[model samples]
Target: MAKLIVSKFGGTSMGDAECMLRSSEVAFGRGASLVVVSATSGTTNDLIALGKASESQPWAEAEKILSKIHSRHVKIAADLHLPTESMQRLETLFEEMGSIAKGINLLKDCSVKAMDTLMSLGERMSSVLCTEAMAQVLKRHNSDKKAMWFDVREVLRTDDSFGKARPLTKEVESLSQKKLGFLRDYKTVVVTQGYIGSTEEGMTTTLGRGGSDYSAAILAEGVAADVLEIWTDVAGIATTDPRICPAAKPIDEISFKEASELATFGAKVLHPATLLPAIRKNIPVFVGSSFDADAKGTWIRKEVEDHPLIRAMAMRKKQILVTLSTPEMLHAHGFLFQIFKIFNDHKVSIDAITTSEISVSVTLDDSTLVNKKLIADLSEIADVQVEENLTLISLIGNNINHTPGLAKQIFETISDINVRMICLGASKHNFCFLVSEDQSTQAIQRLHKKFVEA
Candidate 1:
């Protein structure tokens, strides 16, 4: 039996008519029975802007943004020469979007729930166009395979989180087996939208930014696919971000643990949560460029031949360090729990953390710091200091905590830099530290040269 492959293409891969055609060809050539695609390039951001404008701007202004969005999809549809049915579907979606914008403008309110519904139009429209593209590719190949557009919301069930919903895994698995199991016959190519799912109450919800990959992984696991392919703009995973370190090289293969650490730390190729399902099911994942399908892509698996001490390094910028200090924390067991519970209540995730008897310091994404209520809650128990303009740098590899002299070598390389916080021993795959944002580039370059290049 042929290996079952579920392929996901990023925004740029579906940017325009040509991009969609190329991505369709890649999917077909790779024998992807199910293809998951993101919104066209920049469409999600445009929808977000439309949502904000609808809430604050004049009706005319919101209309203009909506017109722009409509024109984008119309042009792609025209280029692909989509069927009348598909074009009508696109028009109906645009009508719904316009109505939503009008309502939000009149109400002067764009709740997270409304924003999710508005943003979901991006993927919904792209899936229509991509389905036509897939049909054209199948016709061109003169194959008997039928191309079908599948509504992922039919199978991908999530909680009612609206803006960042979590998938209901068991439901997804059962639904996939019942609804998508026909793909096992190898006679149909199913095109589906990613990043968007329906709540148990049937309300539309999104999986947050860069969630397309995560959704694809979830579906792959649900169907028990043999492989998951993530096709993006880049060729594959690199030793380091090429824009930051020009000397960065491509990684042909990587272990799931190291890839997870790299993504959590800041590698943009894969979303931090994308590998979770794949890891649980031990499914191999492929990361490659849809623009250059022939390129050697990176493969992520449970094990690899090489287990280097330092595989790759990542840098996450615009981090905020929150330090909570109080005499109450000294020899206290529940104090840390209280601090963490406050963050949990606010739904803010802490990245790297270090603690002392009297003080606990943690790193968080700069965006999450906008919740003043969280700070206020913490301030009631301890003195809280928020430090911005910080960057978290992580080294992802094997046995990071077990390797002696690793920290010494790293510090020796960047002895001049002031390390604000250090988090280690938590995971053997990662050793992360914080530094000033301005010195992040220099620090990463030096470390890459000393460790990766050498």
Candidate 2:
């Protein structure tokens, strides 16, 4: 069996026919054995909206969205000059989508199960289109072998968790061997859908939004591939979001630990959990731009040659700070446990935490998904103050906690910005603080100049 190279392309890379052609070149030109593709840009959102409308809006309204989605795909297929049989197959998929929407309207309820199935359609459709495009590109180059569409769900089995399913690792490995093992000796480029998995019962589920990267890592590890390539719109991971700070530069190399911190702190380039499988397998991961394949991108591995004081900074906006103050919390041992237990029971993930003798402040992402009952329960233990529209700024590095002068520089740079809460000692790699959302960009730029540019 030859060493496999698994490459994953994000939605923007597969946005249209031209983009698909470029992505195919990246896959085949770079000697990728398997290619995992996300949905065309905006297709998943449209599908979700159509699903929501099925529950409340009339069937006609949902059909309108379905028709729009179908037309987009049809146009792309025609633009790519796909065969008549392939175009008919594309229409068949659109027909299936219409039937699914009609069923959702008739039921008047879009369960998580139904939504996952609908969302899976985006990847399935995109995979079909990409395989055709890549095959054409291969033939044009006079390659004897063509790209093949491999159904990933056949091997990437997971639990019954419909919306955010957890992949069963052992099952995935076994199935990958049984199904993808043949591809090891084959000489064709295998294209598959990302973010979609199936349970043992064969019910379709999703790993979550941005799970396509996770899907790629899973396949690479499952098959023991040499390297996992994540092709996105940007050149690679940057010191900060380029949009927030235009001076932000791309990082050539980073450690897995630092990359994980950046992902957790709100870097959108890679999913936070995408590196777990690759990390365990010791597979080096590459992040590059599909639009500009020749550009130098970031490489994530177990170690890097250099470790800077502040490698990168990330800011997560729309944070909610929950401050609990009570005399009982003063010098109390079990008080902290009680508060944490409530968060655990509610399944709320905290981004940052700071504590005083009599109070504790925590920040969580501001989302409607937060459990209201958790807040109501916390109010019983202590007086809770909730602050909305805040931002979390994380300075990520290597052993920055013990590094002197770094903290001094950070404070001096953002001396004027009001810091709400500071969280340290949680991880050796990061020093995070909360601030008003409006000041986040200014804070990032000042910090980037002070640390990254200097």
Candidate 3:
């Protein structure tokens, strides 16, 4: 029996009619029973812009955005020559989206919940187009299989977290077995939307930005799939971002731990949370290009043949370092707890942290700096000094902490660069530090040349 495969195509792979058709061919060739798709390229951003304009801008401006979105999808539908029923389905979705935007405009409020509903339209629309494309492919090949669209929100249950909803794994697993287990029949190719789920109360919620990959992994785990394939524009996972280092090579295989670290530190190909479900179920993931399906892609699994000390490095920019100093923290038990509690209450996740006798410094996404209340709360407990325009450079590999002279070699490679807030010993797979944003590229180049290229 063939393995049960769940394949997900990224936005670029679903950018246009031709792209969707190509991705459908790849999915069919790979024997993927379940196909997941993101919105066409730039559609999500346009949706976001439409929501903002509806809330604050004139109705004319918001309608213009809505028209742009409609035109783009209409062209795709026209190119595909979808039947009247399919076109009417898309028309209904468009009308629903326009109604939501008009409601937001009248209320002059775009709540996170409302924004999730708006953003979800992107995936919902693309899934319809992709299902039509898959049907055409099946017909072209004269296959007996049928193509159908599955509403993921029915099974992908999540909390009402709005913009960044969390999936209830057990509930998703139970629902998947009940609703999606039939996919094993290999008779119907089910195309579903990624990145959006529904709360128990039936309100729509999104799994955050770049969450379609996570959505694929969740569904893969839900059905106990043998493989999860992520089809994007890029050929495969490289030693580094190829745009940054032309000499970077594609990694044929990587372990789950290394891939997780690489993603958390800022690899754009995979979302940070994408691997959690796959890892839990020990499902192997394939990252390949939908445009060039024949290329040898990267495979992420539990173990690989080689475990390099420094496999790959990733850099995340726009980081803010917050240093909290209070003499009360010196040998104080609850003081540290209080500081963490405040951050937890604010829902700001810390990336890297270091503590001294009286001071604790943590790295956060620069976006969190907008929360004045979080900063004010921390200021009440300690003298808070926030440093902006920092970058986090992470080295992902195996035995990074156990290996001797690794840090020395790393520092020696970039001896001239100023390194701040070193985080190590916590994970054997990651060694991360902070540097000025302006110097990050130079740091990564020098480090990559020394570690990866060498």
Candidate lDDT values, in order: 0.95, 0.90, 0.95
Tens-place lDDT per residue, model 2, 21-71, is 999999887888899999999999999999999888988899889988988
Model 3 Cα displacement at 413 (Å)?
Answer: 1.0
RMSD (CA, angstroms), candidate 1: 0.8
lDDT of 1 by residue, 1-454 (tens): 7989999999999999999999999999999999999999999999999999999998888888888999899999999998999999999999989988988998999999999999999999999999999999999999899999999999999999889999999999999999999988999999999999998788999999999999999999999999999999999999899999999999999999999999999999999999999999999999999999999999999989999999999999999999999998887789989998999999999899998989999999998777889989999999999999999999999998999999999999999999999999999999999999999999999999999999
What is the lDDT for 373 in model 3? 100
Superposition error at 440 for model 2 (Å)? 0.7
**Candidate 1 structure, TM-score to reference:** 0.99
Candidate 3 colliding pairs: none
- True-vs-predicted CA distance for residue 196, candidate 2, Å: 0.9
Better lDDT candidate (2, 3): 3
lDDT of 2: 0.90
What lDDT score is found at residue 147 in candidate 3?
A: 96
| lDDT string, candidate 3, 272-383, tens digits | 9999999999999999999999999999999899999989999999999999999898777898889899999999899999999999999999999899999999999999
Off by over 4 Å in 2: 368-370
